[model samples]
Target: MPKSKITETLLNSTVSKYRNLLKFCYFLMVFVVISCGNDTKSKVSADTNENATTETETEAPATTSSKTILFYGDSITAGYGLDDTNDAFPGIIQFKIDSLDLNYEVVNSGLSGETSAGGKSRIDWILNQDIDIFVLELGANDGLRGLPITETKANLQAIIDAVKAKSPSTKIVLAGMQLPPNMGQAYTTQFKAVFSDLASENKIAFIPFILKDVGGVKELNQSDGIHPTVEGHRIVANTVWEVLGPVLNSEL
Candidate 1:
């Protein structure tokens, strides 16, 4: 072979070897970049899943338990003509219980136009459930209807006796009421006395008048002049709460 031709072949072979080496290096760099990219994606996916799990846990809510306090009465307790029952005094009391995170559930057993006699008839059935605190708000209807004061008093006493019989440990809160002067001064006086006398006799807690600030206030009452307005119920709730709060807190 010619010497020049042999040298040229060697040069070409060397250049080809260099080219192959360059190609291998380029492929290795690409493989490394692809591997790194895959690793990055896996890490990002794991981080996203972890964050989602944490968010789910953080967004969960809380729960409530069962025990009962009952408000038993006539239209006032029933929340007559109110837009929402919750806007009534009983409902307002319930909101307080919830806000305070107290364990007792407030039950409104108010019936529109219910008299003391009617309450006496139904109280036994009401006592069927265990009542922790009982608020008696009857007699207003009896007074309004001009029912016999003696009969009303007797019925109320019977209801109290029944409560004691059913749940001796149950705390009672009596709500007093008054009649307009037109009902006659003597009857009005006697009607008002019934509550004090009973409260003292039974040794139970008493609210002098559930409708103290609420009653006789034009804005506080509904159009009927009998049921209280939402604002009125708020005031009534405050009154009941004054007596009932201490009882509940002590009991709890």
Candidate 2:
């Protein structure tokens, strides 16, 4: 073969090989661009879905329809001296309610050393929430403090009237209290009569004594001899349950 013919043939073959390489590079670039675009779209879709789920969860409302039982009182109801406040009568009552699967929540609004007057002052604030049952145990501090029977009675009545004014349908349970003999028979007797009289006048549920079985019992009371011990709270819970159980059942 001639040298010119061989050179022409080599040139044509080289040109054809270069054209095939260019086509392969073009196809590879197209595939890379398509793949990158799909990956970006997939990431955006995932981010949008994630944001929608977060917004849905954040905007969801918490729906709970549990009735509240408010125990408004002093140290006895506050469970003073107990390591865990849940060991208190009101907390124990909550446990009982939970065990029975009742839709009632007990709020222990018992403050240490809260008297009738103090309770009267704050009762309005406490009543701000919807109360299914309101347990009144305020007078013990009044009696312990040797407050005037008339003033104590008046303060208690005011509290009762406030409760009635707040919600007429709210069940009020007045827990009766007794003073020690040291407070004098005349004063103690009058003080004792105050609760019963209020209960009768108001036509509300009466607890003859909040600490029926637990009060004055050396073993049941704590070292202070004022607040009840864990065992004492158990008995007190039973006492409260006797009246509260029926009231709650009536609601049901």
TM-score of each: 0.74, 0.77
Tens-place lDDT digits, model 2, residues 1-252:
999999999999999999999999999999999999999999999999999999999999999899999999999999999999999999999999999999999999999989899998998799889998999998888888788889999999999999899999999999988877988989889999999999999999999888897778899998888789999999999998998899999999
Clashing pairs in 1: none
Where does model 2 exceed 4 Å of error?
A: 1-62
Candidate RMSDs in Å, in order, are 7.0, 4.8
Taking the candidates one at a time, how many backbone clashes does each contain? 0, 0
Cα lDDT of all candidates, in order?
0.92, 0.92
**Can you write out model 1's per-residue Cα lDDT over 1-252, one digit (the tens) per residue?**
999999999999999999999999999999999999999999999999999999988996666557788999998998999878999899998998889988989899999989999999998889889898999999998998899999999999999999999889999999999888899999999999999999999999999998998788889998888789999999999999999999987986
Clashing pairs in 2: none
> What lDDT does model 1 reach?
0.92
Best by TM-score: 2
